[model samples]
Target chain A: MEYTYTRSVGPVIDRFFSGLADRKIQGIKGSDGKVIVPPTEYDPYTGETLSEFVDVADAGTVTTWAWVTDPRPGQPLQKPFAWALVQLDGADTAMLHAVDAGDESRMSTGMRVKVHWCDEPVADLAAIEYFEPEAS
Target chain B: MRDIAVVATAQSPAIRKEERRNEVEILMPVVHDLRKRAGLKQEDIGFTVSGSCDYLQGQAFAFVTALDAIGPWPPIDESHVEMDGAWALYEAWTRLQYGDIDTALVYSFGKSSPGDIRRILSLQLDPYYLVPLWPDTVAMAALQARALLESDGVTEKDLAEVVSRSRKNAKDNPNAQLSGDVDVDTLLKEPMYLSPLRKHDCPPITDGAAAVILAADDRARELTDRPAWIRGIDHRIEPHSLGVRNLADSPSTRTAGEKAGVGNGNVDVAELHAPFSHQEIILKRALGLGDNVNVNPSGGALASNGVMVAGLQRIIEAADRIMAGQADRAVAHATSGPALQQNLVAVLEGEK
Candidate 1:
């Protein structure tokens, strides 16, 4: 049977997704003062619950990336694309997302990219449609 | 590590369809029954864990609704695995080893009859290569059965005998949905549903829920005079690709059996979660179970194959054997993924 999922995002996760809805990025501050993208409920290293939220620049450098020649069912990109581990500016850790680079040669670990928000607002990871190579 | 034991278990009656209630409603009574039999309250449970598949529920985070059955008013330390209930029990057992929580509750529920279970199981295959072919679970198992017959001396007659024995055993189990007396010779003569597998060779599509309560050392003694202490528990996963592994033998089960100390001590009984008649024979060989060991005293999955809950029921059935003084020691087995790609084994014993 066909089943549709309505997930209830808790307060912390809701806030992070809401930020994406507004075409912005949010990170929770760890006890060590590092801003973690895809904010965690608790610090993996210290096991401390984080309450502080901070906005980071949407523009960031690509850390490590794998090319998604074909996308899965619910992935951010509908067409052929690349999935990148992008370290948003002002954030300590990188988050995964699709990069809309036309060719694989244009995508590299040190290359720069910018957020490409979806046309409509929705509270999910898909809020940001993908990233594109930044113009020189 | 302290000795943890499964003291009580309860399961809802298997049905072809259950439209009167959703997952939580169906599970509430089963969970209550397990707690009531153990003489315990929700507050006494230190940890709660469950196993389920989102693909079966057709929704992501399907487990969240089922949590309502437990009533997390005070909030409890809990987690879930995208696996069978038997694996959830393994996680609970590991938590008990830390000597922090003395008691835990493990449960699993699935409504397989709501959808085509055979088609839904195909999604567990590798998304890239195998899922495109849309190979159903029954057809894959049939391939394995064909291999078992060719590689080993096992015949179609052996498969029919298993079906006959399981149906006969289920006659005494009220909760079983499929139970009757059918001659093995007649069963063999029946038409094949899938080549090398007759209609009786497969488990029925069933909807049900199951719950089991576990306690550690002193807590176990306080809960029951005869606690089925978990002597050993372990689980392993094999490669998901069908072509890469041998279908005739379950190396993962044999590896798990050795790790769980299945034959380290004497075992008087065994409850195997084999959904197919041939699979029980395969598992028995993999676990090194001798002919003297009593198998499937609770009728096993052939009687009521409730998808996710069937494996956990095996653990519960084995424990019940020890708790009732029917046996001094017992073994429980559970499997998951296509073609039994994952396996769990638990050894339980009466108080020393």
Candidate 2:
């Protein structure tokens, strides 16, 4: 069933999504001085409120990947694509997003990737259309 | 804490669809069978609780009708959880500890045929980041499988062997939806539906229900010749963010197993709720079960995963073995959320 209510992205995620709209990536710094990508409101380890926003590079490495032969409706790509958890540059944790590598043969762990932004940007995850393998 | 034991258990055969009946009809017979087995009526049950998901049917409060199956004429004490039945049983066990309840009935059911369960499962993820990406459950599981493959010396053959053993063991389970001999070599040759995971490596879409009863002290003795006494029970959960935790291991399961006293005795049987092949490996290591421990003798979730019902069925399988005099001590495990994020471990035993 469809929910008809609007969800508040809250302050922490609002900044992250706002960064997506500006073609920038934002992360929150944990107590250990580690950057958590696609930022969380509180420290993942300490549960302490975090406000120090860190800008991370859009380029990253694929820590793990799964090739989807058949695309489900509402997925990032209509064609066959791979789901990769990319540890964005400067971020300690991986961010799950679709990778448009054209074929399963091209995807692998530890491969370099960069965000592919949409033509028109919004404060949503859809702002970054998907990730694509970085050129050698 | 007072002694509590599993007195009766009943589960419907795992199937693709029960077209003729809805959730209530699907649950009635199993509840009927379970109550009869315990020789208890509705009023005799001190507390009544059930487990189910409204998202399965895309409707809210869908479990109220299933409660009617129990004939709650006198308005018996009741409750519900939007989680697996194992959690419902855990609640009942806690209530019995208050010394107010002598008996409690727990049941769970699910019908995955009506909706796209893969997409539906995404709702369980973090909506802001994970849900918007729309990574279906299979694709997410495939990520874990790949991490497992690259972590240790575990080969693709190890995964296939898990599927093969599950199918073979299910042959003897009357309630199993899938059962047969699976050739590991032939299975390895099959195309990967989601890379690092073949269709055979995943659980089938199953529609089923299960019921179980718990009694304390001398009341448990009146219900059955042998009550599977609950020695210890515990559950734990890690963070929901998949990116933050190591997918290759389940530390939550490890802690829960330890708290439940799994290592305290020689485990005669272990019924683990591992819907995916590689998860069995993770759980086995976390629980420290040896090769001598019988794992998933009833085929497990690979043979029949009924969402809300599967976890409770694991408890039933382990308890059934103890009640039947086939096993002396058993460890039962249940998991919820994506990639073993939430884990419940229980230890059951019979009088030696």
Which ten-residue region of model 1 chain B has the weakest summed lDDT? B126-135
Residue pairs in steric clash, candidate 2? none
Best by DockQ: 2
Best by lDDT: 2
Cα deviation in Å at residue A81, candidate 1? 36
Residues B1-352, model 2: lDDT tens digits? 9999999999999988778888888888899999888999888999999999989978888887787767778788999999999999999999999998899999999998888999999999998898887888899889989988999988899999999999999999999998999899999999998999999889999999999999999999988999999999999998778788799999999999999999998999999999999999999999999999989999999999998999999999999999999999999999999988899999999998
Interface Cα root-mean-square deviation for all models: 15.8, 0.9
Question: Can you give the TM-score per candidate against the true fold?
Answer: 0.72, 0.98
Looking at chain B only, the TM-scores across the models are 0.98, 0.99
DockQ of 1: 0.02
Among incorrect, acceptable, medium and high, the docking class of model 1 is: incorrect
Evaluate all candidate structures by whole-model CA lDDT and list the values in order: 0.82, 0.93
